[model samples]
Target: MEKGTFQDVNAQVVQRCREGDNRAQYELYKLYSKAMFNVSMRITNDYAESEDVLQEAFISAFKNLHSYKAEASFGSWLKRIVINASVNAVRKRRSELVPLEDRIAGDIPDEEYDDDTEWQVEQVRRAIQRLPDGYRVVLSLYLLEGFDHAEIGEVLGISESTSKSQYSRARKKLLEIMKDTHSMA
Candidate 1:
């Protein structure tokens, strides 16, 4: 769990974890837990449930370490596990996902820019959290996780076009919310 242990997750660490090295497994968990917690909390909106999802994700990742190839970055592989854990947690709670039909196309007006931008990072994060589940997941996967539309489609089991469309709508809605808040201020 120390910083040096996670400085690099090279082939050695992967091999060790694959061979069931407990320290390597713990190192991997500590390396990615914070990022996974943020992702899970954004999806689940419940701190305790998000913590559960984070633990579940690490357990699943460790158990399946043998299947991991070096083709994708370890962070990316772990992200898939975390996202899946969040989605599964939501499904288990039976929280109805916001329907796709609610994201119809429309012209989203542009927001005004200022040299002295006063928006805080926390405000933007809160705005993102306010987005519906469908849009929030797509937005986080694309903008935050750096997943392309096709990769996102594959992960979410949606068509590529659907991923593109969802991303566009999510951006539009997020902009709308930010602008409204700016106006209020």
Candidate 2:
């Protein structure tokens, strides 16, 4: 397929599935299953639970296919479903607590943006994965996913200030991780 063609395929399949076509349902599952699994795994961090989340998310997505207006990309819509499923799985496991600190430390000012872009990308992703859940969620949503504090606050159900604080802490923690690795070398 050509670049960015999957969305077209999904749109067609979704249209068919909306009309109660079973083959379209199977095609949709085949198309999205692996990507959705990764989305669930990223948040849930458990193979079995991620699988369950994927299944549940697919079921939900299929049932709600009518609500998909194709205004947003199909992948984006499917991703939202997968993310919600993963988040629900996490909530089922345990409730997350946001820290009460009202004032977060300042963010690192743009310090001659790192020269080692490749090293930084890999190391930062690893470091982010190592952060506490709250920090990880805020960092992933804000930094990686390009969500503003307000959007993140709505998605994560925390105050915008809390999201900002968590992102600040996540950055600090990532820098610490990078520093430790450099020291080790």
Candidate 3:
């Protein structure tokens, strides 16, 4: 199906779901659950918590379906719900206190490095998982989820500069982890 046609069908399904059609609700979940689960997992960093967050997010989305305007695609709306739910779950698990002093790292100019090394996807994933929660969350939202620094700051309740700082630190840390892994291999 053409992209536009598929999106129209999804919008229709969302309308049906808003009207309390059980089948349409199921269809919507089937279409988005995997991607939502990935978003949840990336934020929560735990399989069980991700699953719980995904379920809660879907339930919340369905309950609030009446308020959903078709201004944005259903998937984007659902992703926002999933991200909010996952972040809430993580916050409930632990208090993320950002010391004011640490919020802004020194202005590090973006740097480029070239290396003749090929890294596996799993290696990169592992490196991401190893980052501290703040760095990982900012990095994932900015890089993997296509959120700009401003959007990430809004989502995470931090300043835009903080988001940029966290992303810079996360990138530097990720590279260090990858280099260590490569040397060991």
Which candidate should be chosen as best, given lDDT against the real structure?
3
* RMSD to the hidden true structure, all candidates: 7.2, 8.0, 8.0
Q: Is candidate 1 or candidate 2 better by TM-score?
A: 1
Q: How accurate is candidate 2 locally (lDDT)?
A: 0.74
lDDT of 1 by residue, 1-24 (tens): 866454355567778888888997
lDDT of 3 by residue, 57-145 (tens): 99999999988888998899999999999888767766756432342233223334354333366568767877777888899999889
Q: Of the candidates numbered 2 and 3, which has the greater lDDT value?
A: 3
Q: Write the per-residue lDDT of candidate 2 for residues 1-185, one digit (tens) a residue.
A: 89868777777888999999999999988888998787666566556778999888889988898899899987788888887777776666655343312111232233444568866775565555566666766776676556799987887788999989888988899889778877875
- Deviation in angstroms for 4 in model 3? 1.9
**Could you estimate the TM-score for every candidate?**
0.75, 0.74, 0.84
Best by TM-score: 3
Worst 10 residues of 2 by lDDT: 100-109
Worst 10 residues of 1 by lDDT: 100-109
